[model samples]
Target: MRAPGDLRADARRNRELIIQTARTVFAEQGPSATMDEIARHAQVGAGTLYRHFPDRDALFHAVLTDALERMIALAETTRKQEGLAWDALSRFVEGCAGLRLDLLISVAGSQATQVATTPEIGEGRARLLKILDQIVSAAHDEGTLRHDVGAGDVMGAVSLLIRGLPTLPTDLSAELKNRALRLVLAGMRTDPAPIPPPVPAMTANDLIRRLSTTGPAKPAT
Candidate 1:
Protein backbone atom coordinates (compact mmCIF):
# COMPACT_ATOMS: atom_id res chain seq x y z
CA MET A 1 0.00 0.00 0.00
CA ARG A 2 1.14 3.54 -0.73
CA ALA A 3 2.15 5.71 2.19
CA PRO A 4 -0.54 8.14 3.32
CA GLY A 5 1.71 11.02 2.40
CA ASP A 6 2.01 9.66 -1.11
CA LEU A 7 -1.75 9.58 -1.61
CA ARG A 8 -3.55 12.36 -3.47
CA ALA A 9 -5.51 14.82 -1.33
CA ASP A 10 -8.82 13.15 -2.20
CA ALA A 11 -7.42 9.71 -1.53
CA ARG A 12 -6.04 10.76 1.82
CA ARG A 13 -9.38 12.25 2.80
CA ASN A 14 -11.17 9.09 1.79
CA ARG A 15 -8.72 7.00 3.83
CA GLU A 16 -9.22 9.11 6.93
CA LEU A 17 -12.97 9.11 6.52
CA ILE A 18 -12.97 5.35 6.29
CA ILE A 19 -10.84 4.98 9.38
CA GLN A 20 -12.97 7.33 11.48
CA THR A 21 -16.15 5.64 10.30
CA ALA A 22 -14.71 2.20 10.96
CA ARG A 23 -13.70 3.23 14.46
CA THR A 24 -17.29 4.17 15.30
CA VAL A 25 -18.89 1.22 13.56
CA PHE A 26 -16.49 -1.24 15.15
CA ALA A 27 -17.21 0.19 18.57
CA GLU A 28 -20.92 -0.25 18.04
CA GLN A 29 -20.97 -3.62 16.27
CA GLY A 30 -17.76 -5.36 17.31
CA PRO A 31 -15.77 -7.73 15.08
CA SER A 32 -18.92 -8.92 13.40
CA ALA A 33 -19.30 -5.63 11.52
CA THR A 34 -19.11 -6.32 7.80
CA MET A 35 -16.95 -4.66 5.17
CA ASP A 36 -20.06 -3.66 3.22
CA GLU A 37 -21.45 -2.03 6.34
CA ILE A 38 -18.25 -0.06 6.83
CA ALA A 39 -18.17 0.97 3.18
CA ARG A 40 -21.72 2.23 3.35
CA HIS A 41 -21.12 4.10 6.60
CA ALA A 42 -17.92 5.67 5.26
CA GLN A 43 -19.84 6.78 2.15
CA VAL A 44 -17.06 5.31 0.09
CA GLY A 45 -17.23 2.67 -2.61
CA ALA A 46 -16.19 -0.88 -1.82
CA GLY A 47 -13.25 -0.49 -4.19
CA THR A 48 -11.96 2.53 -2.29
CA LEU A 49 -12.20 0.79 1.04
CA TYR A 50 -10.42 -2.23 -0.36
CA ARG A 51 -7.73 -0.02 -1.88
CA HIS A 52 -6.87 1.34 1.56
CA PHE A 53 -7.50 -1.68 3.77
CA PRO A 54 -7.64 -5.03 2.02
CA ASP A 55 -9.18 -6.83 4.96
CA ARG A 56 -10.89 -6.28 8.30
CA ASP A 57 -7.66 -6.89 10.19
CA ALA A 58 -5.88 -4.23 8.17
CA LEU A 59 -8.59 -1.69 8.91
CA PHE A 60 -8.66 -2.58 12.57
CA HIS A 61 -4.88 -2.23 12.77
CA ALA A 62 -5.03 1.17 11.11
CA VAL A 63 -7.74 2.40 13.48
CA LEU A 64 -5.78 1.25 16.54
CA THR A 65 -2.57 2.77 15.23
CA ASP A 66 -4.35 6.06 14.71
CA ALA A 67 -5.72 5.95 18.25
CA LEU A 68 -2.31 5.17 19.77
CA GLU A 69 -0.70 8.04 17.92
CA ARG A 70 -3.40 10.38 19.14
CA MET A 71 -2.97 9.11 22.70
CA ILE A 72 0.78 9.56 22.60
CA ALA A 73 0.35 13.11 21.39
CA LEU A 74 -2.23 13.78 24.11
CA ALA A 75 0.09 12.47 26.83
CA GLU A 76 2.97 14.60 25.55
CA THR A 77 0.80 17.68 25.48
CA THR A 78 -0.59 17.03 28.95
CA ARG A 79 2.87 16.59 30.41
CA LYS A 80 4.10 19.81 28.82
CA GLN A 81 1.12 21.99 29.74
CA GLU A 82 0.09 20.87 33.21
CA GLY A 83 2.52 22.11 35.85
CA LEU A 84 1.42 19.60 38.45
CA ALA A 85 2.13 15.96 37.66
CA TRP A 86 -1.10 14.72 39.17
CA ASP A 87 -3.10 17.26 37.21
CA ALA A 88 -1.38 16.19 34.01
CA LEU A 89 -2.09 12.57 34.80
CA SER A 90 -5.75 13.25 35.49
CA ARG A 91 -6.17 15.26 32.31
CA PHE A 92 -4.47 12.57 30.28
CA VAL A 93 -6.78 9.89 31.67
CA GLU A 94 -9.83 12.00 30.90
CA GLY A 95 -8.58 12.56 27.38
CA CYS A 96 -8.14 8.83 26.93
CA ALA A 97 -11.69 8.23 28.06
CA GLY A 98 -12.89 10.59 25.37
CA LEU A 99 -11.14 8.47 22.76
CA ARG A 100 -13.36 5.49 23.66
CA LEU A 101 -10.39 3.10 23.77
CA ASP A 102 -12.13 0.77 26.18
CA LEU A 103 -15.01 0.36 23.77
CA LEU A 104 -12.66 -0.27 20.85
CA ILE A 105 -10.68 -2.89 22.72
CA SER A 106 -13.74 -4.60 24.11
CA VAL A 107 -15.23 -4.82 20.66
CA ALA A 108 -12.02 -6.07 19.11
CA GLY A 109 -11.90 -9.09 21.42
CA SER A 110 -9.21 -11.68 20.44
CA GLN A 111 -8.55 -9.70 17.26
CA ALA A 112 -6.76 -7.19 19.48
CA THR A 113 -4.23 -9.78 20.49
CA GLN A 114 -3.61 -10.69 16.87
CA VAL A 115 -3.17 -7.06 15.81
CA ALA A 116 -1.04 -6.33 18.88
CA THR A 117 1.52 -8.82 17.65
CA THR A 118 2.30 -6.61 14.66
CA PRO A 119 5.50 -4.55 14.96
CA GLU A 120 3.79 -1.19 14.49
CA ILE A 121 1.22 -1.94 17.16
CA GLY A 122 3.78 -3.36 19.59
CA GLU A 123 6.08 -0.38 19.15
CA GLY A 124 3.22 2.06 19.58
CA ARG A 125 2.21 0.36 22.81
CA ALA A 126 5.78 0.44 24.11
CA ARG A 127 6.16 4.13 23.37
CA LEU A 128 2.86 4.95 25.05
CA LEU A 129 3.84 2.88 28.08
CA LYS A 130 7.20 4.66 28.31
CA ILE A 131 5.51 8.07 28.32
CA LEU A 132 2.95 6.84 30.85
CA ASP A 133 5.78 5.57 33.04
CA GLN A 134 7.36 9.00 33.10
CA ILE A 135 4.09 10.70 33.99
CA VAL A 136 3.43 8.08 36.70
CA SER A 137 6.87 8.49 38.19
CA ALA A 138 6.41 12.22 38.30
CA ALA A 139 3.10 11.77 40.10
CA HIS A 140 4.77 9.43 42.55
CA ASP A 141 7.61 11.89 43.18
CA GLU A 142 5.08 14.67 43.74
CA GLY A 143 3.52 12.44 46.42
CA THR A 144 0.06 12.78 44.93
CA LEU A 145 -0.59 9.27 43.63
CA ARG A 146 -1.02 6.26 45.85
CA HIS A 147 2.28 4.50 46.58
CA ASP A 148 0.80 1.09 46.02
CA VAL A 149 -0.28 1.61 42.43
CA GLY A 150 1.91 1.77 39.32
CA ALA A 151 1.32 3.12 35.83
CA GLY A 152 0.12 -0.29 34.72
CA ASP A 153 -2.38 -0.36 37.55
CA VAL A 154 -3.73 3.07 36.67
CA MET A 155 -3.95 2.12 32.98
CA GLY A 156 -5.66 -1.16 33.77
CA ALA A 157 -8.16 0.61 35.98
CA VAL A 158 -8.91 3.20 33.33
CA SER A 159 -9.52 0.48 30.73
CA LEU A 160 -12.03 -1.19 32.98
CA LEU A 161 -13.76 1.87 34.34
CA ILE A 162 -14.25 3.61 31.00
CA ARG A 163 -16.01 0.71 29.27
CA GLY A 164 -19.61 1.50 28.28
CA LEU A 165 -22.19 -0.60 30.04
CA PRO A 166 -24.42 -2.67 27.73
CA THR A 167 -28.06 -1.60 27.12
CA LEU A 168 -27.52 1.96 28.37
CA PRO A 169 -28.32 4.88 26.11
CA THR A 170 -25.24 6.59 24.69
CA ASP A 171 -25.69 9.68 26.87
CA LEU A 172 -26.28 7.71 30.02
CA SER A 173 -23.40 5.35 29.24
CA ALA A 174 -21.01 8.25 28.82
CA GLU A 175 -22.24 9.83 32.04
CA LEU A 176 -21.72 6.57 33.90
CA LYS A 177 -18.23 6.17 32.51
CA ASN A 178 -17.28 9.69 33.51
CA ARG A 179 -18.66 9.10 37.01
CA ALA A 180 -16.71 5.86 37.28
CA LEU A 181 -13.53 7.58 36.11
CA ARG A 182 -13.91 10.25 38.78
CA LEU A 183 -14.33 7.59 41.42
CA VAL A 184 -11.29 5.69 40.20
CA LEU A 185 -9.26 8.89 40.18
CA ALA A 186 -10.28 9.60 43.76
CA GLY A 187 -9.23 6.10 44.77
CA MET A 188 -5.85 6.56 43.14
CA ARG A 189 -5.07 9.61 45.25
CA THR A 190 -2.77 9.28 48.23
CA ASP A 191 -4.11 7.74 51.48
CA PRO A 192 -7.29 6.38 49.87
CA ALA A 193 -7.44 3.26 52.01
CA PRO A 194 -5.44 0.25 53.08
CA ILE A 195 -5.07 -1.84 49.94
CA PRO A 196 -5.13 -5.59 50.35
CA PRO A 197 -1.79 -7.01 51.51
CA PRO A 198 1.04 -8.08 49.24
CA VAL A 199 -0.48 -7.75 45.75
CA PRO A 200 2.49 -6.99 43.52
CA ALA A 201 2.30 -3.73 41.64
CA MET A 202 1.63 -4.28 37.93
CA THR A 203 4.54 -3.11 35.80
CA ALA A 204 4.40 -2.03 32.15
CA ASN A 205 6.10 -5.25 31.12
CA ASP A 206 3.48 -7.22 32.99
CA LEU A 207 0.75 -5.45 31.04
CA ILE A 208 2.49 -6.02 27.71
CA ARG A 209 2.81 -9.70 28.36
CA ARG A 210 -0.78 -9.99 29.51
CA LEU A 211 -2.13 -8.26 26.41
CA SER A 212 -0.21 -10.66 24.21
CA THR A 213 -1.90 -13.61 25.87
CA THR A 214 -5.40 -12.56 26.86
CA GLY A 215 -8.51 -11.74 24.81
CA PRO A 216 -11.38 -9.61 26.05
CA ALA A 217 -13.55 -11.17 28.72
CA LYS A 218 -16.28 -13.53 27.57
CA PRO A 219 -19.78 -12.18 27.89
CA ALA A 220 -21.80 -13.56 30.79
CA THR A 221 -24.12 -16.36 29.80
Candidate 2:
Protein backbone atom coordinates (compact mmCIF):
# COMPACT_ATOMS: atom_id res chain seq x y z
CA MET A 1 0.00 0.00 0.00
CA ARG A 2 1.18 3.55 -0.66
CA ALA A 3 2.20 5.28 2.54
CA PRO A 4 2.17 8.98 3.41
CA GLY A 5 5.98 8.96 3.32
CA ASP A 6 5.91 7.52 -0.17
CA LEU A 7 4.14 10.55 -1.58
CA ARG A 8 6.35 13.00 -3.48
CA ALA A 9 7.04 16.27 -1.60
CA ASP A 10 4.60 18.46 -3.55
CA ALA A 11 1.91 15.83 -3.88
CA ARG A 12 2.00 15.18 -0.12
CA ARG A 13 1.91 18.87 0.67
CA ASN A 14 -1.04 19.46 -1.62
CA ARG A 15 -2.97 16.54 -0.15
CA GLU A 16 -2.40 17.71 3.41
CA LEU A 17 -3.26 21.27 2.54
CA ILE A 18 -6.52 20.32 0.90
CA ILE A 19 -7.69 18.29 3.87
CA GLN A 20 -6.66 21.01 6.34
CA THR A 21 -8.30 23.74 4.31
CA ALA A 22 -11.45 21.71 3.76
CA ARG A 23 -11.79 21.08 7.49
CA THR A 24 -11.91 24.80 8.23
CA VAL A 25 -14.06 25.69 5.23
CA PHE A 26 -16.54 22.89 5.85
CA ALA A 27 -16.88 23.86 9.48
CA GLU A 28 -17.59 27.48 8.60
CA GLN A 29 -19.61 26.97 5.43
CA GLY A 30 -21.16 23.63 6.26
CA PRO A 31 -21.36 20.84 3.70
CA SER A 32 -22.21 23.43 1.07
CA ALA A 33 -18.56 24.52 0.91
CA THR A 34 -17.40 24.20 -2.68
CA MET A 35 -14.25 22.67 -4.07
CA ASP A 36 -13.21 25.97 -5.65
CA GLU A 37 -13.45 27.72 -2.31
CA ILE A 38 -11.45 25.00 -0.57
CA ALA A 39 -8.84 25.13 -3.31
CA ARG A 40 -8.55 28.91 -3.00
CA HIS A 41 -8.26 28.75 0.78
CA ALA A 42 -5.49 26.18 0.49
CA GLN A 43 -3.61 28.40 -1.98
CA VAL A 44 -3.94 25.70 -4.60
CA GLY A 45 -5.60 25.76 -7.98
CA ALA A 46 -8.96 24.04 -8.53
CA GLY A 47 -7.12 21.46 -10.63
CA THR A 48 -4.85 20.61 -7.67
CA LEU A 49 -7.78 20.09 -5.31
CA TYR A 50 -9.54 17.91 -7.84
CA ARG A 51 -6.36 15.92 -8.29
CA HIS A 52 -6.38 15.14 -4.58
CA PHE A 53 -10.13 14.75 -4.09
CA PRO A 54 -12.05 14.19 -7.27
CA ASP A 55 -15.34 15.45 -5.89
CA ARG A 56 -17.08 16.83 -2.82
CA ASP A 57 -18.21 13.39 -1.68
CA ALA A 58 -14.68 12.08 -1.98
CA LEU A 59 -13.36 14.93 0.17
CA PHE A 60 -15.95 14.28 2.84
CA HIS A 61 -15.10 10.60 2.73
CA ALA A 62 -11.44 11.34 3.40
CA VAL A 63 -12.19 13.75 6.24
CA LEU A 64 -14.72 11.48 7.91
CA THR A 65 -12.51 8.42 7.45
CA ASP A 66 -9.75 10.11 9.39
CA ALA A 67 -12.17 11.25 12.08
CA LEU A 68 -13.60 7.75 12.45
CA GLU A 69 -10.12 6.26 12.73
CA ARG A 70 -9.34 8.67 15.56
CA MET A 71 -12.54 7.74 17.32
CA ILE A 72 -11.78 4.05 16.93
CA ALA A 73 -8.40 4.58 18.53
CA LEU A 74 -9.98 6.49 21.38
CA ALA A 75 -12.48 3.74 21.98
CA GLU A 76 -9.74 1.12 21.97
CA THR A 77 -7.78 3.10 24.58
CA THR A 78 -10.85 3.63 26.75
CA ARG A 79 -11.80 -0.04 26.52
CA LYS A 80 -8.35 -1.06 27.75
CA GLN A 81 -8.65 1.09 30.87
CA GLU A 82 -9.14 -0.67 34.20
CA GLY A 83 -12.27 0.63 35.89
CA LEU A 84 -15.99 0.17 36.17
CA ALA A 85 -17.09 -0.94 32.73
CA TRP A 86 -19.68 1.80 32.73
CA ASP A 87 -16.99 4.41 33.40
CA ALA A 88 -14.92 3.17 30.49
CA LEU A 89 -17.93 3.11 28.24
CA SER A 90 -18.92 6.57 29.39
CA ARG A 91 -15.50 7.98 28.56
CA PHE A 92 -15.63 6.52 25.06
CA VAL A 93 -19.14 7.81 24.52
CA GLU A 94 -18.24 11.32 25.69
CA GLY A 95 -15.26 11.44 23.37
CA CYS A 96 -17.49 10.33 20.53
CA ALA A 97 -20.02 13.05 21.31
CA GLY A 98 -17.45 15.76 20.62
CA LEU A 99 -15.34 13.91 18.09
CA ARG A 100 -16.14 15.28 14.63
CA LEU A 101 -19.45 16.60 15.89
CA ASP A 102 -18.98 19.73 13.82
CA LEU A 103 -18.10 17.88 10.65
CA LEU A 104 -20.96 15.44 10.99
CA ILE A 105 -23.39 18.20 11.90
CA SER A 106 -22.53 19.96 8.68
CA VAL A 107 -22.73 16.79 6.64
CA ALA A 108 -25.94 15.55 8.20
CA GLY A 109 -27.57 18.95 7.99
CA SER A 110 -26.73 19.38 4.32
CA GLN A 111 -29.12 18.75 1.47
CA ALA A 112 -26.68 16.49 -0.36
CA THR A 113 -25.76 14.32 2.60
CA GLN A 114 -27.12 11.30 0.80
CA VAL A 115 -24.18 11.42 -1.55
CA ALA A 116 -21.75 11.76 1.35
CA THR A 117 -22.18 8.11 2.31
CA THR A 118 -19.30 6.84 0.30
CA PRO A 119 -17.85 3.36 0.72
CA GLU A 120 -15.06 4.72 2.90
CA ILE A 121 -17.62 6.32 5.18
CA GLY A 122 -19.49 3.04 5.45
CA GLU A 123 -16.35 1.08 6.34
CA GLY A 124 -15.37 3.62 8.98
CA ARG A 125 -18.82 3.40 10.53
CA ALA A 126 -18.74 -0.41 10.56
CA ARG A 127 -15.39 -0.49 12.31
CA LEU A 128 -16.66 1.94 14.91
CA LEU A 129 -19.67 -0.23 15.59
CA LYS A 130 -17.49 -3.27 16.12
CA ILE A 131 -15.39 -1.45 18.72
CA LEU A 132 -18.51 -0.23 20.47
CA ASP A 133 -19.89 -3.74 20.58
CA GLN A 134 -16.79 -4.97 22.35
CA ILE A 135 -17.09 -2.30 25.04
CA VAL A 136 -20.83 -2.82 25.40
CA SER A 137 -20.48 -6.53 25.86
CA ALA A 138 -17.94 -5.92 28.61
CA ALA A 139 -20.26 -3.44 30.29
CA HIS A 140 -23.09 -5.92 30.30
CA ASP A 141 -20.86 -8.69 31.65
CA GLU A 142 -19.84 -6.40 34.50
CA GLY A 143 -23.44 -5.65 35.38
CA THR A 144 -22.93 -1.97 34.60
CA LEU A 145 -24.92 -1.70 31.42
CA ARG A 146 -28.43 -3.01 31.39
CA HIS A 147 -28.69 -6.55 30.10
CA ASP A 148 -31.55 -5.68 27.84
CA VAL A 149 -29.81 -2.85 26.02
CA GLY A 150 -27.26 -3.87 23.44
CA ALA A 151 -24.61 -1.91 21.59
CA GLY A 152 -27.17 -1.09 18.94
CA ASP A 153 -29.32 0.72 21.50
CA VAL A 154 -26.37 2.87 22.49
CA MET A 155 -25.62 3.66 18.88
CA GLY A 156 -29.24 4.53 18.19
CA ALA A 157 -29.47 6.78 21.23
CA VAL A 158 -26.32 8.68 20.31
CA SER A 159 -27.63 9.10 16.78
CA LEU A 160 -30.76 10.73 18.20
CA LEU A 161 -28.66 13.14 20.24
CA ILE A 162 -26.46 14.08 17.29
CA ARG A 163 -29.44 14.74 15.05
CA GLY A 164 -30.85 17.28 17.51
CA LEU A 165 -27.61 19.15 18.07
CA PRO A 166 -28.01 21.68 15.24
CA THR A 167 -31.36 22.86 16.53
CA LEU A 168 -30.09 23.99 19.92
CA PRO A 169 -28.69 27.47 20.60
CA THR A 170 -24.96 27.72 20.03
CA ASP A 171 -24.27 28.88 23.57
CA LEU A 172 -26.25 26.07 25.16
CA SER A 173 -25.37 23.37 22.68
CA ALA A 174 -22.50 21.85 24.67
CA GLU A 175 -24.46 21.81 27.89
CA LEU A 176 -27.50 20.28 26.26
CA LYS A 177 -25.34 17.83 24.38
CA ASN A 178 -23.84 16.60 27.63
CA ARG A 179 -27.24 16.44 29.27
CA ALA A 180 -28.69 14.42 26.43
CA LEU A 181 -25.76 12.01 26.49
CA ARG A 182 -26.01 11.52 30.23
CA LEU A 183 -29.67 10.78 29.93
CA VAL A 184 -28.97 8.12 27.31
CA LEU A 185 -26.44 6.50 29.62
CA ALA A 186 -28.74 6.77 32.62
CA GLY A 187 -31.38 4.83 30.81
CA MET A 188 -28.86 2.06 30.20
CA ARG A 189 -28.20 1.62 33.91
CA THR A 190 -28.97 -1.66 35.67
CA ASP A 191 -30.26 0.03 38.83
CA PRO A 192 -33.88 0.48 37.88
CA ALA A 193 -35.87 -2.21 36.14
CA PRO A 194 -34.46 -2.09 32.63
CA ILE A 195 -36.76 -1.17 29.82
CA PRO A 196 -37.79 -4.20 27.83
CA PRO A 197 -37.54 -4.71 24.09
CA PRO A 198 -34.14 -3.16 23.61
CA VAL A 199 -33.85 -0.44 21.03
CA PRO A 200 -31.88 -1.63 18.03
CA ALA A 201 -28.62 0.04 17.18
CA MET A 202 -28.48 2.10 14.00
CA THR A 203 -26.63 0.16 11.34
CA ALA A 204 -24.12 1.91 9.10
CA ASN A 205 -26.71 2.00 6.36
CA ASP A 206 -29.40 3.27 8.71
CA LEU A 207 -27.19 6.07 10.00
CA ILE A 208 -26.45 7.30 6.49
CA ARG A 209 -30.11 7.17 5.58
CA ARG A 210 -31.16 9.12 8.67
CA LEU A 211 -28.50 11.77 8.34
CA SER A 212 -29.21 12.26 4.66
CA THR A 213 -32.76 13.24 5.59
CA THR A 214 -32.06 15.71 8.39
CA GLY A 215 -32.75 19.51 8.13
CA PRO A 216 -34.59 21.41 5.40
CA ALA A 217 -32.99 22.39 2.13
CA LYS A 218 -31.17 25.71 1.67
CA PRO A 219 -33.46 28.05 -0.31
CA ALA A 220 -32.65 28.55 -3.97
CA THR A 221 -31.01 31.87 -4.72
Candidate of highest lDDT: 1
| Model 1 steric clash pairs | none
For model 2, residues 1-221, the per-residue Cα lDDT tens digits are 23557989989888878887776677656777789988888999998888778777778877766667877898888878847667777787777776644565566544446545767678888998898898888888988888898878887776666555544344344555666676677778886334232235436786455446643334311
Pairs that collide in candidate 2 are: 152-201
Model 2 lDDT-worst window of ten: 192-201
RMSD of each: 9.7, 9.1
Report the C-alpha lDDT of model 1 over 10-33, residue by residue, as the tens digit. Answer: 999999999898877777677788
Question: How many residue pairs clash (N, CA or C atoms closer than 3 angstroms) in each of the candidate models, in the order given?
Answer: 0, 1
Point out where model 1 deviates above 4 Å. Answer: 109-111, 191-221
Best by TM-score: 1
- Give the worst 10-residue stretch by lDDT in candidate 1: 192-201
Q: Give me the overall lDDT of model 1.
A: 0.79
**Cα lDDT over the full model 2:** 0.71
